[model samples]
Target: MTPPVPPARLLVVDDDKGILPVIERVARALGFDVQFRDNGREAIDGLEELDPDVALVDLQMPGLNGLDVLRAMRDADPDCRVILMTGNPTIDTAVQAVQGGALDYLEKPFDFDRLRRLLAGVRDGIERREALLQADASVAQRVEFHGMIGRSPEMQQVFDAITRYAPHVRTVLVTGETGTGKELVAKALHAVGRRHARRFLTVNCSAVVETLFESELFGHVRGAFTGASDTKVGVFEHADGGTLFLDEVGELPLTLQPKLLRAVENGEVQRVGSLDTRKVDVSVIAATNRDLKADAGAGRFRSDLYYRLSIIEIHLPPLRDRREDIPYLTAAFVREFAARVGRPITGVTTAAELLLQRAPWPGNVRELRNVVERACILSDGRMLTDRDLASAMAISGQAAASAPPMLPFDEADDADPNLLSTVQRDQIQRVLLDTGGNKAKAARVLGVSRRSLYRWIERLHLEA
Candidate 1:
């Protein structure tokens, strides 16, 4: 059973009493939950409380104007779309309103058709945003691939490669930075490959003991070594007629590389302390974070082994290079962590979203997941705010330096009356300078709205 969609909330602010009735009528007809404000000052004051999806304001009003209210709304809730309507409309005023983030401007003696069309468009946009948010909620579990969630062009290319190569490839080499999900690709290959019904085994080359490396890769006979209490079958034999995933393959010892190459090239393995070679039909998928080509050239890795593995190689792009995917990734992580913690966290605040965008994710997707999990654990409400995420990031010791600097406490300490203000002012100034006077970007860096940024600029007497 599908749930009924909620109506879009609309706020109408106008000094003219005549305009109020018409707005109420049109808004109600459009299925909007409408609120009316007689003055711009009241609308500005109630902006945060109303949290409207769309706001319609009069151009000129007493005490405050529509432009001022629009600016205030933009700061308090950047998601809201605003339209300015006026009796004395001009081309210059329309330009100013649009430039100030007004979605559209209207003249007096309103055209009902135009107004209906505009309202319908706004409603459609609202529906789309709501749909995206709902989709994000299920993204953690409904990922297209094997726990892999991405829609970027780079990831699309990877998906295409996986689709094309999975069905036919035997020995595939997956290369990417740590946490770029190389193992996932290996699983994908096996899942889609002809050996889907057979066993898929994983062996971490870096995790295995140096002495036990040979025994781990190939079966060992009784009394093979010091720990030979019983004859044991290795991962290769266990995954016969299936796929064997070698994680961190670059970490495999140079001396053992020749044996691994022989096993991969020929479907055969020689057990330790035995001259007999047993044939096993197994597909090999090797993953590494290191540049095996460079290692092979430098005489650290076997060139023949490298060449064999390079026959089918898939490289994953770093998270930094796919910044556009961060929003989707963040949403998925938020949903996953929220469910894990039994919280009702829906999403992040706009300012927090901006902070995430500005962050330098050196650790890739794994790091982002950890950060989101920490934030979810710390969050107490439906939405994760900038402060909650900041606290979580502070624990990592990375956000404190890379993310926007938090301002001083509201209360001034008696020991340093002006010190706090001085530091706060300096931080704000530095961020503004770094953004080259881009108030929107600077506000995002400082985790504040544009209106709040304006207030700080005025209060601190700082120039753009």
Candidate 2:
């Protein structure tokens, strides 16, 4: 089953009669189960009873002001995201609300698109905070490899595949790009399988020199080579009666393919510089970033070996491919690095998350980790500001720190942009610029049908 959104319980508090239904409609549309309150007193009572993931309050409320409501809500639970809403907002008020521990402040006549963006950032912040708590192994293991983070159906399918293959003592092949955590999947399979108690030895095929591959996989007798002073067992012997982890298996040389295939077929090994053939029982788990079949067809790898290793195969989606997992993973990484580095960096600020979601992370999770670590080191206190993230991302020409967006709102017409519309505008503009006015090229660049791009162009109002 897919994981539900972490923040289902939400309370919307505003004094104006018009505010309640709009808040309710927006919150409900965003899949939040919302409770509405007319003023601060009712909001406090509702918050105490409901204990929501977030509380949206108006700064000007009858009796106990919005600040009072925020103070009360936070005093009850410091974690709840309290966003202050106001019309005719001022710089002084924004500073006060932020300093007073409000998650963020939104202007009146909600920018639904911006509001949605804020909620996403709030969810990310909550994840990062929780991840920090989880980083304490003593606390609990909150992040797991299979279906632990994302709500997408693809991830659920991957989870199901892992569950199905975790039991048997067969060799499994895991294929994925770097930073997708193929090793994590291997470990999970071993941990969840019947061989949980046995050793899980890992060997990086690419790290081994061509001459040392055999010696590393099979035991080397004394005087096997210049460096072999004494008898040393190889990974196969060491992992006997257990599991052997072969990372970057696609890097294994063609000359050793026959030997590896032999070992797998016979369940035994032959020591180097010795006429000894030893019988050893071991299960193999292999991981690779290359297309093994293509490599085999190109004579880079052995087809027979590929089939043997791939009795069960699992492909992990890249971080960008599984965009739903970024917030979860980014949150986890931030918490972990902050605690390790002894920084109170509690969460990524709203602008930081916007930059993250908008960028194309070519380097995947590893790059994200580095960014989080850099942010952790640069951050001063409990939150990671947009500035902390800016230098690390290397997006060469980022926008100015703070400026009103170019898109003007029609407040008089009640035309608030939604996420889909915002995305369409962004896509159209991005593709148009990339294609240099060639609509066909723009459609291909966007991975959308030409007709779809044309429709988007018409909808978003384009110059090209």
Candidate 3:
């Protein structure tokens, strides 16, 4: 469900009890959690306590003028939105108020309509700032599997497939986009298999230089090449009677695919400088982000080798496809990062959670983990807020600090349904973006059911 926005904090300062009641009523109706003070002195004292989003101050007050309080607030928190009111409105006062960073100025008896509009504007400004912060909050609840967490049906299927095939499969192909936890799946397959106690080594095909591909996988004797100073067992030989994880398998040079195919098929590997072939019993687990079948068809990858490696294929879903699992993933990340950084962060604010849920997560779980870890490192409070998140994420070029402008809300009494839907769609999009495109979270924030959200998405053609 979409979480509710935090109430805007309001500090009202006025000596007139008559005016205070009206302002309090207005603030309450606008969904503000308010704090009141009769004099400027009291208001200044309350500033530290309330830490308000918008402050309503009478220009002329006992003990301290409204301007004094404004300056104090500016000194304390320049972000606090302020509004100045006075019975004797002057051009000088108005000019001074704006210079003082007051959002709006009012005189004498307030125009109830103007007052409502002004307060509403202030309320919106607060919500927008909160949304910005919420989107950035990084701490989450912890749920995981060998340093991973996923509960979506797609992820569960991947988990089930791992368990089902690990004990029996000879060569398993794990394929997915980068950051989808392919290596973890590879580890899980090894850990759950009968060879759990045996050595499990990983070789990143992309990381190795092209010339060293054969030597790295099959070993090379001393003086085999300019850099081969000593005889060393290669990955295949080192993982004998265990498992060999070939990551980024698509990057394996086509020239070396034949040699790798021969090793996997016959359990035989030959040293680079020797003629003798050594027999090794090793399970090969190949992972790739690329579509090897398509590559093979395109003649970039060997079709015969692709067929051998993909005898048992397990595809991992991208983070976007499994939006249902974000919360679990977030919680797990929060816990993991908190422990690593020795921070007492327990969870993320609702705004923060919604923002995290809506992200596209182009980098997948690994990106999410790194984001949370960065947030943990930067956090000061026990709970993570949007500000902490925004600060961390902004470094990556995401506009996490500024909230998107809200759609216009004031419309005719008999507004067009289509027009209303457009507004609704805008709101949904904002919420979805804040939640990182998590439909369930978006629905909750929009106060609609998941089924309703889906219908809206279909009708509106929402990117969600």
Candidate 4:
């Protein structure tokens, strides 16, 4: 047999020549191919040639420092893992490095055991990413999961639900506000799962005419209707053995609900003219902005149909609610559409991000994606500027202006307060003014809501 494959490669870079040998010994002993560098800059150049599975970088270097190397490594290969070794390690610096995507940082004279563990963790992470990439390549090599991006905690929950439910060949209902990417989610559900091998169909229920609803959905025999001269197969028949996504299902006419329900329940449909009932296996995925439960309660929707369609429910939170994930999502969308539209756009600028953070994306992710796409297509270079977002932000600002001031009032404070209290009140006013005075939005930015937000605003007695 041929020689066994070598262990995974690990790159170790530092200025100290002696430390290089120690790390090499440790890494080789641990079954990793070790590469060394005398300085951070050289390490990075070597990184380009070596493509090491993981990198161990020192914090202190003459020309290019450890932190600098970490930054460069991340900029070059976002997926690369950089473990920082620092002689003068501080909590703030350590936190900054990790936040900047450095895998882990090791203090000078760090326990070799701890270093090894961190390296192993990085290796595992890289392996998992590679596996996912391989799977994607095997499928369609596209990065987007529907219109959604980011593997954050909240989005991951949505993705896991999509994966588990998409392959079942059952009806699904996705409920979310406008611009929340309900359609993208439906497409993603179709892209994978059991329906991957078959046709995936879509129709916007709200856009269809009630008069043609039956004909459009169930098809028609030749010369069966006023517009029909030839035979036509309904979406159900076309999507047989595949997925049929009904977006905005809540907007479908009340009259059409029964027929839609019948087809879903029995997997049988009758053409507008043909007397015979044809059976078709069509997996349905529905989405709506309206509250289906309330609609059912109001007798607008069939309760039985609601139960049948809601076997899998995906509720997408508004963008503002998941503000923490905005940066990642924005970056992803920028990269994607920029590449697709053949533009030079690289990413959202910091100031643009500040505007994004403050503005209310009432339209949710759909609006954000549109804004980014526009910016990407129009931008001259890699960076999306604040100017690109000016129009949207102006509209958001006008909306903010019209909305009632979200000020917190204290019942007791309204009656009376001391001079010291007034000073506290002034400070709160300043904070509110700095944060645009939208209490609910400000509260999120300040990490306080419910009781504390109003108290501070009320205490300050400011128009926040």
Candidate 5:
């Protein structure tokens, strides 16, 4: 049996006591759970906790008018659809309301028919958006591939290459930008290879010290060095009969490149201070974000070693290049984080999803994962909204701060510094002062990127 959907939440903010009952009656009749706020200030303060699906705000109020409330909603709960009500409507106020992100404008003496249609439309839109999220979540589960979620043509090619070469390749080089899932590709290669039952080991070439590189790659006998109290089997010997994933392989020291080349070519490794070499069968998978071909040509890396590893190569595309996969990746991350955090979050709001899709993911999949995880942790409702995502991006230092404000300012008001700009500048100044002029800290407090904060400082002509 199909379950009944929960009633949508509606918040009514109007100073007039006489109209509250009318809106409540009509809204409840249409299956809405209604809440009332007598003034815009109270409505603005309660938006985060109320998490309303729709808000009806009166344009004229004693303090904090409808436009103010609309701005608050945009910051606190961007998924809420807002309707502005005015008793004495003017062309100017109507334009301002629309520019402030109001979904619709309502005139006085309450046209019950129009109100009913507006409420019904909002409910339908919410239902459709929720249904789409569910569908995308379902597809995300189906398209996930070995800890990676992607459906774009570039990703499909990567998967195909993995499948085709995993079973046969002994030496494979994986290349891509940082955080592009090169380690996952290496693991997939090991998983699908013939040595799946054997041990799979990893070593970050960039993390190892210069002097310890040889000992880390090959075994070292006891008393081989000053502090060699006990014999140690290196990753090569430990992963014998299996696969060795050398991450950041481009950082490998030039002096040790010849030894690595010999190991990869002949499956032979000589321990430190040992005269004899031991033969071991091991599959080597090297991954690097750097251009090894260019590095070899420039004499930074060995051409022979580069050629040996590139015999079979797999490249993973960056997240931005494969943006068609963003939705699926977001859905998967939402599910994973929700389960891990014990949250009821089913998916992100449509606005939030659009923000994720439009973002320039400089850190690739890893950055997206961090953003989603942060949003899931901070989310208070079932759906993640654009406000939540923006805050997450800002904290992660990846937000597009140069983007225009959500509320469009009039051209005439631009020269005079409108209310929104004043509010923004004052807020930034206060945060900067509180943080001792630390731009990074101020950016986090303001929920903006450092680059954005710098732009704001320059545009506002602030000292710091």
Candidate 6:
């Protein structure tokens, strides 16, 4: 059942006590829960407690004028709509009011009709935004595809491609930026494919050492290398008649490309330091954040291997390009984290949703999920306000700001450390410890890629 929308809050700060009654009547008629302050000082003091959706302040006050109240209100709640009123109006003060983030400036002598219209407009806007948020919450539940929630046309296309190719494709490539859920898409393909009942193995190509690439993909005979103490069955053999998801495949060593290509092409793999070739029927799903085509053009990757892996390519769009999906994603994340934490957080307020929609989600869905998770943890009420989301985003921004410059993990130790680097190191260590040395869980909590977390661990010289 849908809950009733709360009344829009309106705060009126005017020195004249006589005008308070007039404003209250009009505001209450517009369905506003109204509060009155005799001066700006009192308004500013109570601003945090009232947390009004709209504020009407008189320009002329003894101390801390309307402009002062507006600034305080903005600092307290940026989403609040402010309207300034004054009897002795000037062009300069009017300009200052507008520039100070006033929704509108009104001349006094009480144009009751104009005031009524303004109040009604604010009420209608608040109600409309509330309605949209409710609609988004409903749509979020309906538009889920597998574990991913998106209604954007780009995501819809990707879903269609997965449905069409999963049943038959042998080799597929999923491409997108980090945190765009390439791995999820790979899992979705495997789940719907003919090999659904078989083992679905995943190998993070970047995480594996270059020397172990061949042995990891194709089994190694005992005594093949210094650490080849036993004849180990590789992923290719273990996942025979199943799916092998190679994440960050662009990070695979150039020397091993031919062997990988052969495994994809002829379903054949040769164990390291062995003469015989083993035929294994394994479906490969390769995912990478880098453009393999561009890398091939630059001679950084083999063209033949790239072509073999990209028989059916699926590209996932970034979150910024799909802004319309932000609300739905937020709703889903809120519900998920709230349930996981056993909180009663119904959803984010309309203002909070607006803030999320405007955010530049560089980390894409993962970053959004992290923020929502953090907000859910911080919130103690049924609805998450803008303040909750803002605090979470601020923490994220601080961590991002303290991050060291991007360098290869192998060379990270050589870079000089600074104060910001120290802060980042401490934060990573704390999260790692909190997650009990689980790099994957820490990465999700920190809103970073596992590869990035690994690099930070190396760069910061942490025990994890």
Q: Model 2 residue 18 lDDT?
A: 81
User: Which should have the higher TM-score, number 1 or number 3?
Assistant: 1
lDDT of 4 by residue, 1-464 (tens): 11122356788887777787777777777678887778877777666455566788888789988788888877655556788888898998899888878878888786889977777776666556545533443452122366666334567678878888877658878888998778878888888678788988988888888888888899999989887999999998999999898888888888888889989999989998899899999889899999999999999888888888987799888876676456656777776887898876656655666666555788887777777777676667667877776654454342322232222222222212321222234445655677555443454444543234454555444574
Q: What lDDT would each prediction earn against the true structure?
A: 0.79, 0.72, 0.77, 0.71, 0.81, 0.81
Tens-digit lDDT track of model 2 for 206-307:
999999889999979999899899998888999887888899999998888888887787887888888988998888889999999899888789999998
**Overall local distance difference test of candidate 5:** 0.81
Best by TM-score: 1
Q: TM-score for all predictions?
A: 0.58, 0.55, 0.56, 0.56, 0.57, 0.57
- How far residue 441's Cα lies from its native spot in candidate 6, in Å, is 49
Worst 10 residues of 6 by lDDT: 406-415
Weakest 10 consecutive residues of candidate 2 by summed lDDT: 408-417
Superior candidate under TM-score, 1 versus 4: 1
Steric clash pairs (candidate 5)? none
Candidate 6 residues 124-221, lDDT tens each?
Answer: 88767665554544553324678887656788788889889999999999999989989999999999889999989999999998999899999899
Per-residue CA lDDT of model 5 for 350-404, tens digit only, reads 6676678778888999999999999998889998988899999988887653442
RMSD of 3: 18.5
User: Cα miss at 2, model 4 (Å)?
Assistant: 27
Model 2's TM-score against the true structure: 0.55
> lDDT per residue, candidate 1, 342-391, as tens digits?
98887777667666666776777888788889999998888787788788
Give the winner by lDDT: 3 or 4: 3
- lDDT at 81 for candidate 3? 74
